[model samples]
Target: MSAYRGVRIADFTQGVAGPMACMLLGDFEAEIVKVEPPGGDRLKDHPGYSAWNRNKTVVTLDLSVPADLAQAKDLARAADIAVFDHPPGDLEALGLDAASLRDGAPHLIHVWMPPYGTCGRWSRMPPRHSLLAAISGIAFRQGAHGDSPIHLILPIGWYGQAVMAAGAMGAALYERGASGQGQAVTVSGLHGVSEVGGVVMVLDQPRLPRGAPQGASPSYRLYQCGDGEWFFLATLFMPFFRKAIDALGLGAHWEVLVLNPALALDVLEEVFRSQPRRHWLGLLADAGVPCAPVGNRTDWFAGDAVRHAGLRLEFDDPVRGPLAMPGPPARLSATPASVRSLPTAGPLPAWGPPQPRTIGPGASRPLEGVRVLDMGSVIAGALAGAVLANLGAEVIKIESPEGDPFRSDGGPFLTCNRGKRGLGIDLKQPGAKEMFFDLVRQSDVVLDNYRFGVRKRLGVDYEALRQINPRIISCSVNAYGDAGPRAPLPGFDPLLQAEGGMMAAQGGDAEPVLHTIAVNDVATAGVVAFGIISALNARRRTGEGQEVITSLLAQSLTFQLGEVVTWEGRPPAPSGGIDCVGLSPAHRYYECQDGWLAVAAETVAEAEALLTVLGTQADPTDALTAPPEGPLAGRLAATLAGRPRAAALDALEAAGVPCAPCVRGYEAYDDPWLAENDVFVAWRHPRLGEAVGVRSYADFDRTPGGFRHPVPDAGEHTRQVLAEFGLAPERIEALLAAGAVFEPAAARSHLRDGGAALFTQ
Candidate 1:
């Protein structure tokens, strides 16, 4: 049985963020009932909905109707946790909000995901994924130059933020078990993007005019291979740089370039262009510089390493015969992650009456009521602990005596540490080591992201922790792997971004660029979290736990391995510019009188059909045809540009081409197709008024449905949580007096208004 075999989740989510939280929960064996409105979730019509909405039970509710709203409340009351997305005040307006649900079910765990946070200036803004990407500067950052405005291929910022929400919800679930009371977790896509992009934001201060570019050094950059493919080479450290140069037989130019980075990059680029990618890759691998090939989605799943690692999962789906999906990334020697089955489509299956299980105080739960001591400096380890906590693990966060550096004056720290108990432990203090070991004895996992050996110096290393709890899972995250020479170097998301060639890839040939969202950090967090879960699963079978480790540098390197390997042996080539038209003449976007439409012709037959609509030659190979010099390129561009976007789209689709209009973020809310599919729902908010939200990507057939609360206020459950933890009034006061814990002052005002209470315990 899965560790979370009996857990129940009431998912009241719309769109990717809240649904992803539930998706992770379902993966761990939670009984998740996804609640939707009578129309259903908006994601059912989304391009990628099938991939995200799986392994879930779906139910429909009409919150605007009093009878249906009452039923939703009852469902929440019976659930262990509820996940939802709403603006600041929607929950209160619905009367099925967090406070009401918690009042009915004191032990319920509530998760709320929103764009921006519930309290921010943009909290009430009706922004979709792309809009969030635009507002957070992610879209703008991907422009050719720093000041330009070019959107990226996808809404990566929102995706990363969604994962953060998933981790936060998990942590909150774990905490609810400890105190026997539910707490509210509020997550914001904007804040999540901001946190990931914090380094760039900080460096952009007026005083630091030359704010750090995504690439601070040339060692981390991309080079064009002989086959016209892109290869990412990340040799950030001097030794790796030396090795790469030596492997490439560029010794003569090395000394001059090494001393002057600008000169070195120029020389290396010239040398790299001299050969095709494969030739250089073989040479570089033998010499030891971390490298990879830049690959498209198709190349990603087909790559050798991915297949060898078993990262692609094929499952039987009721709607689609053989569905192929990305497998869980983390690997364990014992109990590895596996794909159960593809998600079912349509309505959810019916579950029988609720079966509630009760446990007295101190009785162990699955994970044997394990405790996790989180000491990670940033979000990665903190998020991992949160995942474990969702599975009934108790995670205690040990912050610096001064406070967590990530607090960013309370925003980030509060967001990441929602469900975990917080204690200020000054490891630098004289007796702090003893207190730590005592805590370790009670913990099943000790997680941190400090520089590789820093824990040993602090006396909290795996060996030391094992002395206290022999079966403890000690997991460490770093910029690079723990034992490599570069392991000692200080690094973070941005640094890894540069070193892993993400910046170069994002920049293309223009200049290094940093994504507004921290892709490396969030992706690494997911990888690490998977590692921790896999290790825990192993312990169940082996009667032992072991160390699970990961690094931003390693994850980043692996992420680009496909492209990097492709660039080896190839010398650099001059820019021939993007062949956007060549990518797909039939598959390209066409402008009509109304708007733009994206047409995809994946097959030769489809390509021919699209060409017929354009009244052009119906040849699939037409895309490969080159334009005559001068006015020909301009003429074709004008012809396509002159067409009405809608008419062109209609003609193309009528001919059996896969086509859809490119709807901007805000416009997506009003799309008829999406509305027909029940992708967007309008809910009234008490404070923010009316709001429209997206639905989860996955849809299950057997569970209760929908989100339970709107976004929560900061530290929204302090007093109630403390009381549940069995702390006497005096003790609570004492701790408050010592500055050991705190609750937001606004929580009191909300309580008086019968608003949801916010707290940090």
Candidate 2:
């Protein structure tokens, strides 16, 4: 996009989250100076390193050396942003912590990413993504049917945190343009875990039973066809569910199907198994039911949809030969993102004072005074608005008179709609449409996930909104991009998992398996939020807003960034299988005397230490690379099979190997360390009573954000929100009387007394 063309970033981070964050910034044409050790990043041996480190200048400098350290400080002083992923106190010891570096560079935005958090009990632990996932109870939650934890091959939290941190960086940059100053921010593995687990990491909420290994429900899971191929059926909404049943000629059994879904699965299964995958997919698509065939990353990467969507990028890297991978996850119309080039060799750039811009309005948080109209429903779009609200924006969620259908999904609704005030209005009603247009004129951004053509039908699409307020930034989240074979179709997270190879990868050689975590949905939220913030920053510079688009399909590819790339000599990327345990012997979950423990030994040194602790005689180099079912895993498993979880964890930690117990249930949120850091917050909901959810995704030292209020019930704040927007009480009452706007409590009588007929007419 070149939105950040003149901005320079000093990237001192390594591994997944830090490198991915810097890569996203680089994609926007920021000048990234990647500072590595004499050898390279710790992840240099990994396959995705090339993709994550693209569009940057590489320079080697050891901070332990006084001369090199001085040069690093000089580069940090000159850059607009400096990112780090060093251990808790390592940077402070080297005089490169935020305070140390920012003392001389007041305009530099310093971002520090820790494995756990800056002040948690595990703060000193190594930056191991798998271990973090294990300790946080995420892995345990992934176990289908309440079995032992499944070690996820994907670093879900890291990627989620990366996108969140990128957004935070953008917000800080925007704020700096006003205050002529910078701030320190933190996006840790804990934040990443919370980002993905927001829907489940709740206090007092009854735990949902882990579903079948294949899928969660009949209308929202994978199914096998006559030809032995599989596809996901995602009739998540009522209308889609009805279409699916009617298409299957099961309309007569609708009542029974809805009341006893488990029993209906048998009938549906028989019907689906009677046909081939192609037959079902075609039949379902014609009926408007969201479905997709199970496919691997290779097939998806080479698909026509990816090509038509302009999501496939092919380039010949000087080091990696010919390569193909997915492009950036979002589309900004005016400042469209692009893949410029690979990392180039260069020396550190010298420092100079940053140019100053005229000061703008100041606030307690980066986006304190910004107003947003959240016209989104469900996870992807709704969570994007929640993120902005958490960042200090005043977000008002606008729903139809009937309210968001997802509100019935209590936990997910609470998670995604937190921090937003709610208003229920009938946009199809002329009076309501005028009231919304008034909101558009006063709002900085409007977010939605209505299908490609639905927004236009409602007269609230980007073009429609721009006409009302030229400065209104429209952020739309869709299943696919704006133009593609799949763009017109409906989609859900599991459908993408089936279509984009996640199910295939997780299933290994067996039937396609659905990963319990909502990886695509959650990641898309972070990605869309980042795009919105970036677009806002661009607007600040150009004095105009633009359309920013993201999709579940794009995020599906993004979640597999490291593995999706194809090159002539690329090594096989790590993947999970039927076991769902892990990718390799050195980086999987092992059963102990009491419980399961996740171990991560990425380096030969760490592998050697792991073997030493297990008292196993094996070559660490060979053992680390052995297949999950190989002799090395067998030996480690045999030894660990007798050791207590705590003792093994202690020995592994003492020996410098990263490991953690697979915590179960919501107990991890109550950990003293997590509680001390306020990883979870508590508030009272209007209908659900007491509630808890993860805190904001990142920590900004000066402009920090936290839980402001509970999720609003439909129209809960209609009167108050309108008053704040300058609407008088009498006008609001007239709108309510006209049935244009509504409050559930106040409208209950009216609706009961035939006001509901207004919708039917």
Candidate 3:
């Protein structure tokens, strides 16, 4: 059985964030019914929809219309939890505010995916992936200083937010089972990205010179091999480097180069250039230096390692033939995630009428009765919990008395917080801490991403809560690890890009640059969420839950460890920049009138093929002996200046030389081959209209997968939520008057059968 088989979700979402949350749930076998506007969710056409929107069903209703609103309320009423995206005030207008929803469905798990959230100054400010990246400082950090507009690394930043949102939803679902009462969980992408970039933000003493190359260390740099292929070498530790040197028979040079690191690098580069990449790879493997050839998208899918890892899966789709899709990264021994089927094309999948039930007998799901409380302030926390919720855990989101901060970040929030419940609680109130503790006592996990020590001051610290429930698993995520020197510093993704080595490494030898995508945030969230799930699995066997902690700083540093560990204790070296054209006759990027193609050959046979293509034969030994200096580069540049890109690529490919067009950003979206592979899907939306693009990253077999909803308006579930929480009409009035809660105007007309009266408690 899947981990989340039979799990039920009340999906209130639109956009990427919340839908992503539900997607994870769907992947694990949770029954997720996406509630949408009478028109539909907006992201049906988001680039790569086929990859993102998988394993789910969809339904639409005009929440602004009274009858539809009532139906939405009924849906929430019948669900174990409901997830939504909206600021606090908007909930009242939408008729699906947290107070109303929780009042009606006390046992529901609520998740709110939003932008700046409900309370902060920027809470209501509109946002998108670009705006978030720009405001967080990531945009400024990407690319060469004077290069094209700063944009994120294609789709990666948005996907990061989606992953975090999914994890948060999962956690909330896990917590709901024990509390017997739903709670509100929230996540923000801006904050999530910030946490992921924490390490660079926390540096007490800057070590490297500003604008230095990221891989300045000799042990962790890319080199061109004899056959023209590029390969990375990362011997991060001195011991590793020593091993490599000995294995390469360069011990005498290494001993003599103790005084100058540049000399060492030059010698090493020369030695590496002596052999083809493949030959060096074999030797390096025996030497224990971690290295890999720079791979393109085509290479990634076809590579042996990726294939062996089962990172790619094939599924049959009605519209497309066998579809190739990426698969989830985490692998469990017993209850693994599966891809049953590709997402169906057209309007959202038709969902059956709502049904209510306490429990059903079946083979156990991984998180059969786990309960979670998610109070994530940003993307990382939200996504971490969402993954758990999807695996059959009951998760409840605890919003601030004001509301979640992400309510204003636009579609991202809706995309991240689908399929859970929401509850607003004023932690500052006299009894609020007590209420929180009560909820914690009933929950198996409590997930948060507040700055270090915030939970302690707020009386939600794990030490204090463990006394109330020793088996409670607490996961705290932050920008920096708890004990680091910069642990207390606040950070966002862009700042981390400058601080972490990513920005420097990504832009080649240009200015230190950041990836347009929020890699740090997304990667950290994934790692942290994975850690939390692992802990939960261990707890199952031990009946003892422990704390799982991670930080953006730790994750980013881990990702860049190849550079960090190698550069540690080593002084920077003056750049020994490679003369690509001069280094090898067959290594070059040829420019056609319309485009460019990179061609590489690393063996004598391959070189011979290149010579045949060029219709020239110089002495092999003489060509190899040419000085790697200016004249060679100039001559090569002239030789391949105006060849047609396609023809050149075809010739190289036919000759067994590796060659490909270097595509960036939107151009990748237009690639017909990608379309042929069914990597993108088309979906119709009510508000933003039609969208056609890439889907989720991976594919699963044996379960539902694909886009189901557009991004949702804020608090789309207010009225129905309150009704399910059992709020009485008169009492709800008093609470609203007391400023305890609200629902959006759109949702207000949907209240049915005097269900608004249960919120007085």
Give candidate 3's TM-score: 0.49
**For all the candidates, what are their Cα RMSDs to the real structure?**
13.1, 4.3, 20.2
- lDDT order of candidates, best first? 2, 1, 3
Best-to-worst ranking by TM-score? 2, 1, 3
TM-score top scorer: 2
- For 41-78, candidate 3 gives per-residue lDDT tens digits of 66554423454456766667777788888878777756
Q: On a 0 to 1 TM-score scale, where does candidate 1 land against the true structure?
A: 0.58
Per-model TM-score on C-alpha atoms: 0.58, 0.95, 0.49
Regarding TM-score, does 1 or 2 come out ahead? 2
- Candidate 2 vs candidate 3: which has greater TM-score? 2
Candidate 3 RMSD to the real structure = 20.2
Candidate 3 Cα misplacement greater than 4 A, ranges: 37-40, 86-90, 115-127, 140-150, 200-216, 226-228, 253-275, 344-761
| Model 2 residue 262 lDDT score | 83
Worst 10 residues of 1 by lDDT: 752-761
Q: Which stretches of candidate 2 lie over 4 Å from their true place?
A: 143-146, 200-204, 356-362, 629-635, 746-761
lDDT of 1 by residue, 656-746 (tens): 7665555433344465544543444554333334444433212222111222232223333445545654657886566555544455542
Give the better candidate number (1 or 2) by lDDT.
2
